[model samples]
Target: MTPRRAPAERQRDPERTKAKILEAAKAEFGAKGYAAARVSDIADRAGVNKQLISYYFGGKEGLYNELTASGYRNNSAITDPATPLAEVLRQFVFVGPSDRDAARLFVWENLEDSDVGFDAQREFMQRQVEYMRARQAAGDFPDDLDPGFLLLALISTASAPFAFARVARAATGLDPTSPEFTEAYAEQMTRLVKQLAK
Candidate 1:
């Protein structure tokens, strides 16, 4: 086995350094929440100079926004009329629960500060609502359903398990964060969407 490299040494490459810092920031913000998270803690977790985060991201808010943007980009895709609603929801369930840390960060955003990525996320969800509206017009979904609420329900369904993974695990004795659980849950999520859209 290759010997483990020191944290500072691990960040030698600039791109690697930036990625490391983002990851560390995600974990820190996930665990401690936005109001309580500290830059020093992030820097220590990343194993880089505290100044490097400022140099790369401008400041904590910058890093947080970047994480929010990239997290949404990484998890969900923009859907069109050709995209199957069930499939889109399946992918969301698949990606959303797998990243427990991101779910935690989302909890922080919702409970502590809802302004973290409001504009961009609203724009993205608006597009989804329009797509859903088209589908409803075409009779693929219920005509009575509000498009925005449909999107919210799907998103919340996927996020709920992970946002409270620890609590669920404690209460149910099953690891909701596990790969097996996510795969099963994704199937259920897709099935539920299919039933709802019928």
Candidate 2:
């Protein structure tokens, strides 16, 4: 008698398939922004049928929402305002894998004005702002500086490696994702913010 396959062996690798779809969606969304990205395009890039995207994520909007949610969760996991500012900044800037595609997709979605993913993005940003304010009140940051400005400065420094890698390379002849660069930038920015707060 022929050996029977296990139930798990017969089942599709849902996690792998979902990861592929998400990777494809990240590229398409980053390239086209949410309003212009097409579900068919993501399906094609993932080498899966368009129906599978619908089955797994409902549609393009759902996929975008999932990606945004994942990005927010990743950022939240690393951020802790209670920590010393330099340590917090370092983790935010360089602790994660240097997944440029994922980072670019997140930033692109965040900057776009389209309503498809704005609610979740706005909520995430508001939470961050509130966190910064709380830290300021706790004497972790200076009260004289506006919380919004401090938030933007922190975001810019944390996101610079992703947002300005090309410019950084051309100007500094260094890989933005390199440990040396992240360390130097984190140190410099931390000092700058500390001085500014005085």
Candidate 3:
């Protein structure tokens, strides 16, 4: 096995160290929530000194903020103007394993009644509503439908299978998180959204 790099060498690459810390923070916060997650635990998970987290991110709040911001940015891909809303619905329905942590973080926030990222999240949702309105104006959605309600329904549907995996499995007798199930669900959602547009 190759020898591990020294701490000084690891500290030399700030970007890599910050990335490791952020990744570790995501896991920790997902597993324990912001209030319960400890900075020392994140540092330990990242294999770095606890002080490094403070040095790089100022503290747990800053780390959480960065993760929340990054999550929103990453999810914005579904809002690409060129992609049809049906295809967008399909993409949102297929939440792969890599996205589980972010989903879990959302649940944790809800459970704790935390509003740490409320402003940003609300802004993001408003943008989705605006996107739906634009789609409606473009004739993709019927004028009769309320764009805000449609967005709310779409978000609920997209997040349901992941948020209630055990319920989904019990109801459908299939692993909701499995690729087969998600693919079929995604296709079904895509078809359903297409119908809404017609």
Per lDDT, the best of the predicted structures is: 3
* Backbone clashes in model 1, listed as residue pairs: none
Scanning candidate 3 in windows of ten residues, the lowest lDDT window is 92-101
Q: Please tell me which predicted candidate would have the highest TM-score against the true structure.
A: 3
Pairs that collide, model 2: none
Could you tell me which 10 consecutive residues in candidate 1 have the lowest summed lDDT? 72-81
> What lDDT score is found at residue 197 in candidate 2?
43
The TM-score, computed over Cα atoms with residue i paired to residue i, of candidate 3 is: 0.88
- What is the clash count of model 3? 0
lDDT of 3 at 186: 86
lDDT of 3 at 172: 78
Query: Where does candidate 2 stray beyond 4 Å?
Result: 1-8, 95-97
Per-residue CA lDDT of model 3 for 1-198, tens digit only, reads: 999998987657889889999889988998999999999999999999999988988888878878888887788767866667888888877644447877788778667876776666777788888788878877777998999999988887888776688988998787987887888788888888888767
What's each prediction's TM-score? Answer: 0.82, 0.82, 0.88
Per residue, candidate 1 scores C-alpha lDDT tens digits across 154-185 of 77887867777787678657788777777877
Q: Give the clashing pairs for model 3.
A: none
Candidate 1 TM-score, C-alpha based: 0.82
Better of 1 and 3 by lDDT: 3
Per-residue lDDT for 6 in model 2?
Answer: 98
In what order do the candidates fall by lDDT, top score first? 3, 1, 2
